[model samples]
Target chain A: MAAISLRRARTIIRKTLEKGQEMGLKPLSVIVLDEGGHVIAFERSDGASPGRFAIAQGKAYGAVMLGMAGTAQMQRAEAQAYFIAAAGAALGGQMVPVPGGILVRDAKGRVLGAVGVTGDTSDNDAAAGRAGIEALGLVAEV
Target chain B: MAAISLRRARTIIRKTLEKGQEMGLKPLSVIVLDEGGHVIAFERSDGASPGRFAIAQGKAYGAVMLGMAGTAQMQRAEAQAYFIAAAGAALGGQMVPVPGGILVRDAKGRVLGAVGVTGDTSDNDAAAGRAGIEALGLVAEV
Candidate 1:
């Protein structure tokens, strides 16, 4: 089983923030969670709202727990609100059904970890996260 | 990265309970949080309900995390119910949108911490929290 290293997580966070800056997006909060949905690294940019931590962690947790990207969870949230709501409860409110959560995969398509970003439009957040993972030569399963 | 000192947090809790007693309010639970939203001090007056701690901490956490007083969060909760709900979920239910939470600030208006009081009416609870901060010569951004 592949795992995300702490060094890699730091790089991902740095790249994610850099991407957000380059895109002129709002200050971002980013989190990297290992395949088991445990946080490996997290950071909130200056001026970012404090709620970003919870939102970012929740997004990554949801993606890792559900074995899919946050985009899919968001679609499921629309189509199955009751189910998603129940799932959120079942996850102890640690799952956020939204974009900006992307699964990271190794070369053989094995899940490595996930990246979650917040503090901007969901699409922009997702793009930034993807840029971070791709920069590390890892696949971003968005 | 301004923070609330332990001594100041203790003073705020004492003053908050004192104000509650002066007003003949019910036994109150008070909590102070540092700028990072971590609890700095907490006190529960005798006869206060067991649930008061959670409510008080929730209020204080909400204020600190949102960088505003609970009054503002309460208003936003009404105008943006969905957003508030999502945020609450993201916070793992640690945020309670109510009036008893007040932000503590320094002379220059930088946030230092937050105080939360619960027991009496929301307005009275807020007043007690305000008194606590003011007693310590700090600004209460209520």
Candidate 2:
């Protein structure tokens, strides 16, 4: 249960955004959350939407808070804005739903932390984030 | 010059929220912008609508871009969407039409940064944002 390091977060962002570039996606914003789902770092690429950072942070926070991938949480949150709203209120307004993030885990499946990205389609964003994490030879449990 | 760091952005957020408390305003989302009007730090206080962060940032960015407060920009933009939209497009959508933000200047009237706040009515939000900048001993040149 080690705390997520800034180095890991930076690695995740650089790797994931590198993938995004390969895919010809727009600029991206990446947010890294510690095991407790607190933001450790956030970076917005030039030309990313103003919503990029907030959405990215939200996805990462949700991935950790729900102990699942952000895609699942997005489905649930879309159908139940009230629930998500309640969750955000419950979590000090740290939870957001937009897409492009996932939870990282070790071989033993201990939650390492979460990385969220935004600036393209939600699906693409999530894939890029996952690819970023995978590039580091880490697995995304969610 | 170095772009504003996340640490300085955090300072803007913390100090703005503190000013909000002193003003008896609701929880606010605060934004700080660099000379180029990029978002430096962003935070939404407990209970602030998720929309507030975007709005606040836009307000601050818009203030810097228009060389006036957001309230003034809104009116000007109503008359000229192209002016607003062109600038916003150039900025990748960081400018918003809402109010409740101001530019911060040093005692000698040098532009330092911009702060935008939102949580209550746009007017109230701008007032709160103004209070935050004022508390920092910074004045608005416009």
Candidate 3:
């Protein structure tokens, strides 16, 4: 499996922010995490709330940990609210069942990492995250 | 970036407890955090519950992490419950959205640190935090 480099992580953040700006979305916070659920890079746009860091990180962390997109987690959360809540507790609050987390995958469909975005609508956040991963010539497993 | 010194952190804790006593408030727990959200000083008055430590730390941690006073966080928590809940989880349960956290600032309006007080009523906790910062001749952004 390929790994996300620091340079690539930074690029992902930049591209995510750029997409948010082009779409005239709210100021965003973005985070890239390696497959092990470690943060590679994170940035919060000016005027974004402080909680953006945790929210974005949680989204990506959840994706990486569960091996699924945040949208799937959202469905799981709805279908199994108690289970998801327990999992969130077990993960020490690292899982966020939201729509802004996207898994990064290599061309061979191996997991690379994840990108999470916040500070706008969840749908818009996911779109921006997808744009970021695609801009880096990687697959965004949304 | 400016940092909060140990001497000042201790002073803030002392003054906070003093203000609580002067106000005839209940036993209080106070904590001071550096700009990086690390604890600098902590004190719990006699009869304060053991949980006061986590509660106080959570308040200060949230303020430092978010670049806002605990009062502001309280409002934000009300307006954005889901986002705040996710952020709290991402923080590993280190954030408590309440009114006891106060941001310490320099004369030029740069964040220096934060103080959190608990055990008393939330309003009184905030008042004590403000008094502590003011007693240290620093600005309290509440």
- TM-score against truth, every candidate: 0.72, 0.53, 0.75
Please provide, for model 1 over B1-142, each residue's C-alpha lDDT reduced to its tens digit, 9 standing for 90 to 100.
Answer: 3578898899999999999999999999999988888988899999988898899988988888867588988887686454455667888688888899899989988878789889999999999999999998899976
Local accuracy by lDDT, each model: 0.86, 0.72, 0.86
How many clashes in each structure? Answer: 0, 3, 0
TM-score of chain A of each: 0.97, 0.86, 0.97
Off by over 4 Å in 1: A1-10, A23-27, A34-40, A46-54, A71-81, A104-112, A119-124, A134-142, B1-3, B14-27, B36-38, B45-47, B65-69, B72-93
**Root-mean-square deviation of every model:** 4.2, 10.6, 4.1
The most accurate candidate by TM-score is 3
What lDDT, from 0 to 1, does candidate 3 have? Answer: 0.86
| Local lDDT at A114 for model 1 | 90
Ranking by DockQ: 1, 3, 2
Estimate candidate 3's RMSD in Å: 4.1
Candidate 2 lDDT, tens digit per residue, B1-142? Answer: 3334444555556676777788788877777776767665556564454466567767787778767777677787899878877888887687776677687777777776787777877777766666656655567532
C-alpha DockQ for predicted model 2 = 0.05
Compare the candidates by DockQ and give the number of the best one: 1
DockQ, all models: 0.35, 0.05, 0.31
Query: Which pairs of residues collide in model 3?
Result: none
Between the candidate structures 1 and 2, which one is better when assessed by TM-score? 1
Report the Cα lDDT for residue B20, model 1. 91
Worst 10-residue lDDT window, candidate 1 chain B: B79-88
Q: How does chain B score by TM in each prediction?
A: 0.96, 0.77, 0.95
